[model samples]
Each structure stands twice: as structure tokens, then as C-alpha cells.
Target: MKRRHFLISGAAGAALSMARPSWAMAGAPAYLTAASKEGNSTWLVGLTEQGDVVFELPIPSRGHAAAAHPFRAEAVAFARRPGRFAVVLDCATGKEIARLDSPEGRHFYGHGAFTADGKLLLTTENAYDVPDGRLGIWDAEDGYNRIGELPSGGIGPHEMIRLADGSFAVANGGMQTHPDYDRAVLNIPSMKPNLTYLDAQGLIVDQVEPPADMRLNSIRHIAADDTGRVVIALQWQGNPLTAVPLMASHRRGEALAFFDHPETVRLKQYAGSIAISSDGAEIAVTGPKGGHVLFFDGATGAPINGRALPEASGVAQFGDRFAITLAGGLLEGGASGGKMLDVAGGYSWDNHLVSIRRV
Candidate 1:
């Protein structure tokens, strides 16, 4: 991939002086996300699991999500989907260390993950001209250089996560989009969203899709539990009133076991984000469009419980429970039955809430 990389003017020295040796410094955050306030100002934020803000760094534009390095106090904040840029920040000093630009005809899909060793960064991308999905590999240990690319095994790969065994799983949302058309779905009738598993080298090991009848259900967001079973969130691209299965769980070499309980139908045909409990026993799917958060048994795909939360936008594992973010700056459910915390500061949380686990 041909692109430009820049160290923020004059911040290089500060980065060298203040960069932490590890993520054990005071105020090391447990979660990372992107938020936006008035006038389109945006920031990549770090927070403790209990809703305390650890740090916030400015970004050039609205970001979709961010990838926290497993070992370092650094993050790569991705511009919203189809956006051409991602900024790398040195969290210890709150400095912009580097900038990544997509090559011609390719754009970031708004999400990425660092390898377990924190030596490599793998990002989801759109080879839009080919209408294909690509994984951009970067040398995280060497100034975040773009080293190579890999096929994503399908089209429209959105979110990618490193699995327990060092492989990866990706959600290929399947609806083709191009920046020229500005997020318009180009092939609704033929859309075939799928969840694909890749070996450590990025070769497809296994892939599966929703039942043929649910072909229009776009597989967008995904989360993996401790056992390597993946839970996926879907957005219906067909009739809004239709009650189709919106969540499913899968293990490689096994068929997708869907969670089609009655509550799923109430999600308004869209699941905006998903999370698997740290213990691998529960799952949460947020439907901002439907105005609710639904829980399910992580192993069985059965309904556990759900709650109505207006404009709920992001969800991630927080201890035994899940932390949820709502529009208007409200963060709740960080701990089991925990009270709500208003951290909005006039900014709304974006689509994904990422946990920064120690390697």
C-alpha cells in the first residue's frame, strides 16, 4: 500500500521523553473510544472501567473506533468508515506521534487490532475500487509503518479481533460501498454478509453466513469470548418491520447457532455494537436504532435479559457485566447493577467501546 506517514511537527521529542515503558503507569485506562462534541471537534478517549476518564487526545476528524496497543500507552484512532486517515497517539504525553493515510482506492473501515506482542497492527480496509476487503498490516514497533496487506476473505470487512489462539476473526458486512458514492450501498440484492476466520497469516480457515433466507442481514459487529466462539451483530437491510434473527454465535467447524428470541425482533432490525463478557458467559448487543440493549447466554444464544436505553451506542465488557454508552454522554452498566455515570461533557460516544487488556 502506497501512503504517507508523518510525525506530528515538533512532538517527536516530547514523545521520546514521556512515552511510558509499559502500561503500568498511573491512570492507565481499561477502555478506549472516540467521541464528538459540538462544531465537529472529536477526541480519542481513555477511561477506567468504572467510567472515569483517564485521558483524551484530539483527532483531525470524527473517529469510528480506536485500537489500544496491548503493551504500550499508545492508540490508533481510525477516522469514520471510508475515511482515509488514522492517527497514532502517544498516550503518556498526549502527543500525536504519527499519521497513516490510505493508498489510492483504499480506505480504513474504522477498526483494527494490535498483535499480541504489540509488534504489528492489523487493520480492516476497503479496496473499494475492487469492492473487496483487505487487511492492512503495519509495523507497530517501528513507527507504525505500513508493511503489507492481506485479503480479508470477503467483502466489506468491518471489525477484526485477534482470537485466543492467535488467529483472527472478521465481520464482512457484505454491502458494497464506495467513497465516490458516499456510503451508499451499491449491491443490496446480492449482499452476502459473513463471519470469516483466518489463520495467523491471514488465510481464510473457515467462513460462514446467515441462512440463505436472511441474505440481506448484514453481519457488521463481532466479539469473541474466551473459548474462541464468536458472537455477531446484524443489521437488516430489508424491510424494517420484518422480524429476522439479529444475533448468532459460532465456533469454527460448527454451524452458526442463532439467537432469535422474541427480544431480538424488538431491536428494530439493527444491532449497533456487541460485547462478550470477560468471563465468556454472557453477551450484549446494543441497538441504537431500536433503543435497547439485549443480553444473551454466550454459550447457548438464549435470551438472558434486556433493557431499554434510548440512543444506546456502544457496549464492551466491564468486569462481570458490560459497560454501555448512551447518546448524550451517559455511561452505564460498567459493573453489574452499577449506577449510571454522566460523562458526556457535550460529546456523544461513537460506535464501538474497546477494552485494553494486558498481554
Candidate 2:
């Protein structure tokens, strides 16, 4: 299949460009990113297949996660800190239409999604010292008015996703912290790591717990394909210094080990992000510790190939290509500590979105 390429231009001029090589599959995608001048802000850049930044939208907060409205051209972005509200932006015009406080609290470590009809927004709240996790609902019509709240099921509800059955699947990383950002204390001794499936009204419909041996692993980020299968990314709670392999899959009530590649498995510390292709044929997981993107067959859970990327902390699928945000270099007091350090070699910023297409 011949790949189509598009050029994306920024308000200034050519920001970036993407080229879809012909060797790529028929449905494969090419991606481009628009980065922000301030690393702490949610800068939205629309791109063409040729990797050009044609339009840019500057969001008010450091957006940790985003979900495109199911049917609308707009998208919802969740801020990390300082700015605690989940704001909805007009993807086309780059305007803020609605902003509302997240029921999950002032510090949401990147978790928010939109309902199937685009009528509601769901997210997990993480306020330090606050043991209770909040599941917040916002009415999309009234500028994201808070309608209700529910238990996030566990402490530190970091990520939440919707299932095919119209239920909510959440990764409640069982850890406790103070909302002031003064301290982050982990509760490893009594850690209960599990996947909770909730009904539309936030009722627990099904629960799948990790194996007894890896109970200390905290399930963090989750991604679902068209078939309703889920792939969860885990962050270590028992020991941040320990390298543990805890990547796996779950469907209905069954759980299975997916990526056991020695090189990939050894990256227990780098399980920061996971994304599945729209058609359910490909899955990509990023490991900042390993500085690589691992690709696997979505059905078999077997490693296909991997690509080297910068310290990628977030991953997303734009059309057919994969988009990754590099934050490793953004850490304070690192070798690349200077403000506006060159990232991913050519891409520079505290936060940058890079799209990968097969050559």
C-alpha cells in the first residue's frame, strides 16, 4: 500500500513535518507534534501526515492525559498540578470552552476520559494526604459542571479507562500521599493491586487481581483496543529502586502474561505508558529507564520489534501512528538540566510530543 504524507505548518511557518514511507502497511499512520514554549503547559498542535504543525492551542495547565470527544472534533485535557481542573478545548479553534474542578482533587497524576456519547467526562483524583480516591463526573453541556462523585475504589487512582460494555476500568495505584506535594509515602505492606470494572454509575461489576506473587506492583496506566481487551502498565510501589517485570493483559475475568521478552521484561522500572492501535493489531509500551518503545502483536502479546526514543513518559495513538512525550530530560538537576534543553537530540523542550511511523 502506498502511504500518504502531509505537511503541517505552524502560525510562524513550518513547525514540523511527517512522511509516511511506502513500505509501511496500508493503514499505518505518520504523526507530528506541536510543543509548548513553557514545558508546564498543555500545548496542543495539530499536524499533517508530513509532520507539520499547522495549528496550535495553548492549554492552561500541564496536561498529563487527554481524550478526544467520541463524536465531536474537540478534546478534554487533564492538568497535573497548580491547575487542578479538567478543561475542555476546542481542537479546531484552540479555545477553552469549559473548565471544571476534578472530583479526584488538586493533584491528578494523569487520568481522565470522555463517555461514549461525549456527554460526560470521567477522571480519577489524587490529592495528597487524602486517602479517599474520587471518581468525578462532569456534564459536558454546562462547561463541564460537576454532576456527581464516587469512590475511585482504592487509593491513588492514577488512571481510568472505559470498557466496551460501557463500564469503567480503573488502575488504582494503591499508595497514599499528602496533597501539598511535601511528601509521597507508599503503602506497600498492605498493597492490594487489582483491576476494577465499574458500571456506568460507578458500581463495581468485575474485579481482576494481579497474581499473588506480584501483588506489590501498582497498576497505573491502561489502554483498550476495539475487542475490549486491556493492557495495563504498572509502576512499582514496594521498591522504586527494584527492577520488577509486571506487564500483563486482562479480558473478561481472565488475565495473561503478555510481554516476557528478556530485554523488555528487564525494564520493570520503565513501565510508564502503554497504547494500542486503533484496529487492535499493534501495541506499544514505553520504558523511560530503557529509553525504547516496545512494539508487540496485540492479539498474541508477542514482541514484534522495538524503536529507540527519548525518555518517553507518555504514549498515544494518533490515527495510525504512535505519539510519545519525552519527560526524562525534564527532570530537575539532570545532565540536561538547563532550561529549554535539546530533547530527543533534535526535538527540544521540557515536554515534547513525537510521532513514530514505520520506515
Q: Please name the candidate that would achieve the greatest TM-score relative to the true structure.
A: 1
Residue-wise lDDT of candidate 1 within 312-341, one digit each (tens)? Answer: 788887667778887655455532355677
lDDT of 2: 0.58
Whole-model alpha-carbon lDDT for candidate 1: 0.78
TM-score of every prediction relative to native: 0.90, 0.74
- Model 1 TM-score on a 0 to 1 scale: 0.90
Backbone collisions counted per model: 0, 17
Candidate 1 shows a clash count of 0
How high is the CA lDDT of each candidate model? 0.78, 0.58
Top candidate (lDDT): 1
TM-score of 2: 0.74
RMSD of each: 4.8, 11.3
